[model samples]
Target: MKELDCLFVYPGAPAGKKNLLPIMPAGLLAMAAYLERNSVSAAIISLPSALDGEFDLPGIIRERRVKLVCIPAHWHRQAGGALRLAEQLKRAVPGVRIALGGYTASRFAAEILKEHPAVDFVVRGDGELPLLKLLGSLGTGGRSLGRVPNLAWRGKEGVTLNRTSYAAGSATLTGLGLAGLRFVLNRRLTPRRGICFEDGMFTYVQARGCADNCSACGGGRDAQRRMCGRRGVALKSPASVVRDFAELAAMGIKEIQLPLNPLPSDAYYIALLKLLMKKKLRPVLKIELCGLPSGKLLKWLGRALGPESKITIFAGSGSEKIRRLNRGRFYTNAGLMAALRLASRLGVKAWTAFTTGLPFETRRDFLATAALVRRMRREFKIGRSGVYVFSLEPGSPLFEDPEKYGVTLRRRTLKDFLAQRGKYDMGYSTACFTEREIVRNLKFLEKTAR
Candidate 1:
């Protein structure tokens, strides 16, 4: 058997709305592409699929002759499992270099490396390129590790750190060579089982990072700039945006998901939609656009994509008070009303999404969101739009300081959330919010949706 050069391990997290379908982690996919581009053979193994824990990872590595093991740690939820997996990989392949990279890797680098001695190198920030360089350097006779940026390692003396540099500028979506990625994952990354959409599965990004200053959001303003060392939203060039969709269509990927934060400009979105139409991509081209559309924006989208176009609007709250707290300035009830009104008139399938139990939220606040959702459904006949309860996301400000908003961190840690065995999975848990208020508000929202 041919020796496997590298084994890229994609750590899993609990999935589903009620615990629903597996979301392909784009970061791991992107890194896979980068490694393959540099002539490194990489295989992605998703731990979530090993639910019964039947997969013999050590035996597999031995069979495949694996060399390097790279695992990405996401927030607190996957950190423990990912770190454990890293230790296992180290034990399985003593010569194999184990590395950790991801959002949490960058945010809590010092602490993670100190705690996880199994991790030989910590790839901080956007790790694709640095990881590629590191792998290439290792492939040859041992070379000085001085060139690779965002690398943290411990030596004979002590720990050594390198300069911070990203795989590429976070702004350029075109920099992400999807055409290249699709080729590598063609064999390894089979279509995700039980996704929301069937026969169409592609995830593309129109923009990287966010501009919102929400103190709770991990990628909000200051944090984003500090993390990426840039200001404002960085979008993929319009042509690159369109090309990605077109490529997916060519590959028989019918539904393309664009998870752009803060959304992209009207012109960029319109241009990309027009390009997709030119290629004749079919029903349900999904995108997590940053807020409710504006009246003018809705009109433009409707005209450009036709009534059959489906778009999910992520409006976290209906109450102005709650919106103010989340720093969700993109939409107000008035703005949302206008957007929904236009969508209804144009015959577009628009879904209004809201989350409950925000920091500083009260019973009145919950009622406000429920009432607003009910009104939207009634007024616009937007039956498909509904409210989603809040879950604690570590990178968000809500997790950073839960107490400030009159909530207590009941779950305590990631382990507690993981050990849960009931209908309510981590996705729906309000670890910080009181259970009574959360249950009451969620019931109200569900009733209103019905």
Candidate 2:
């Protein structure tokens, strides 16, 4: 009966393990932060916490009395549960509008509209600016829903599909008055005295479109144009990044993750690290590199964070051939080891991630990956290393040209991925690797890695 504007729902950790991943929902938080600046009162419900019995999601919905409930269908694994939540919300408050967005919803908006009746609108692409416009249009009347870019909604005749659109760049984040990533959960925001790193793990979108050509990745340049409607990578100014980092660090955030492909040019990263050092930002900086880490890059990071700041660099497999095929890296194990050694000397803990099941990978390839993990653990003091199964995501390069990559497309539908959920990692075998091979590889890795 009442309208509280908008409610952003994080569908929560997918089926698999019950442990919460130590990362903030950055995309949703950015939208919520933007909406707040535009003067809209939005409530957020983190379903993972709710599912864990940390909070009651339905009660929050009733209390907020939101006009629109926005569920994120970003990851395919979240589709089924997100839609399920939308259905429940609709039943609780039938008049309320239920909308879905993010990668999964964006790619399958039309199909979701045709199949699911409870979902009202599908917000595609980036929801930061489009969300503001959608809420504004909703305030006046729901008639202008079609005018909003990157939206799929039902019309009188049938489902209306709008051309996917891209709004905002990395520079858009610089204009935010205050970073409001804290409201990712339903609990009322209590002002913390300072930055509590444990309470402040957040994903920092350093760059927009990835320049790397990782054939299996969805965030690659080709996938960006096809999926998110962006061209080349758009980066924030080095100064802007420093400002945001310093602000987050001052607030007491102990860890901050930057998602970047090779992290701009060495000069850009060098400058960022230097400025961060000057500002005395001591948070544990986690950098996800699309390729191998360079010696200079490692040195600058070491200097920037100082000796006390813990550094974690996420890299791919040790097998150069497999790394090249899976991640498009041109470096060898020697180079990676050298960089890791340098990072170790600088007190940087390298976080290596190995994907067990990938296109063109065999039992030998899996063993190679495991061997590299062990070598790193033996030679360099690795902070953590784990093997993850490669999920054939819809918009990825392998998904597009599986034949070229020597892989088969088994899971192609939204329901297919929904059926996977947590199992997408290693619980289930994919077309590339059989269940027996996966189990053998896992056992070998478990024995070797330990």
On lDDT, the candidate that comes out on top is: 2
Model 2: lDDT of residue 290: 59
lDDT of 2 by residue, 5-72 (tens): 67887765444534223232456667778887788877676654443466555666677667678888
TM-score of 2: 0.86
lDDT of each: 0.63, 0.67
lDDT for 379 in candidate 2 is 72
The list of candidate 2 runs beyond 4 A from truth reads: 1-3, 14-24, 50-65, 182-185, 188-200, 260-264, 306-315, 381-385, 424-432
Task: Give one clash count per candidate, in the order shown.
Answer: 4, 3
Off by over 4 Å in 1: 14-21, 47-60, 63-65, 137-143, 156-161, 170-172, 180-190, 194-201, 226-232, 278-283, 306-308, 382-384, 401-436
Q: After superposition, how far is residue 50 of candidate 2 from its true place, in Å?
A: 5.5
* TM-score on alpha carbons, each prediction: 0.82, 0.86
* lDDT tens digits, residue span 105-212, model 1: 655666666767888887766667777778777767437666778787766766677776553554433666573454332233445532112234456655556766
